[model samples]
Target: MDTKFDLEKISQNIVYVKPVVTADLPTEVQDQVGDLDQIYAVHNASGEQLALVADRKLAFHLAREHKMEPVTLH
Candidate 1:
């Protein structure tokens, strides 16, 4: 295996975890979500949204399940 090539691919193998506040969201979205005040947003290194989970642990768990490293964004 090429370690140098693998190292360069690390960025694509990362997932970003961030917190989202339903209260700060649009009223229609907030209403649609129903009682979720806080949630975790998972994104790829390229800034594409991956998933929205209920908690931090689940967010990380999801990344691992998909074989990607999970990282906290801010």
Candidate 2:
């Protein structure tokens, strides 16, 4: 008998999923960003297009700054 997989159960195994554009993105990045543009795209070493990255470094920096932490990568 064919059994259907439970979405909630399946979700627990997922580490990451495809990203999409959202209203939460910064205005500057949002202005330049496109409906189809992914803030971050996962790819193989060869650089093939894969998943979308909705988050950006600047946004992370802003968050870190708010917490008074160094956002710079060393």
Candidate 3:
């Protein structure tokens, strides 16, 4: 038996974790991350930010918890 799959569907579960500057974030977000210079952001395949975590580990962990395959972006 053979099956065909769409590339877009295959990559739907992939997400990326990238470091973001706290200062560059919105005023409300900056206020939430007080005293921290950087944070991590989890983004989906379409580049929409899903969540903002305090550290890289948490970012990846959160993605996995939601059944997403997380990759690091530098």
Residue 6 in model 2: lDDT: 90
Q: Give a tens-digit lDDT track for model 1, residues 26-72.
A: 78777777787898889998899899888999999999999999999
lDDT of each: 0.88, 0.44, 0.92
Total clashing pairs for each candidate: 0, 1, 0
lDDT of 3 by residue, 1-74 (tens): 67877878759999999999998999999999989999999999889999999999999899999998899988
Off by over 4 Å in 1: 1-5, 26-28
Best by TM-score: 3
TM-score of each: 0.79, 0.24, 0.86
Candidate achieving higher TM-score, 1 or 3? 3
Which of 2 and 3 is ahead in lDDT? 3
Sorted by lDDT (best first), the order is 3, 1, 2
Evaluated with lDDT, which candidate comes out highest? Answer: 3
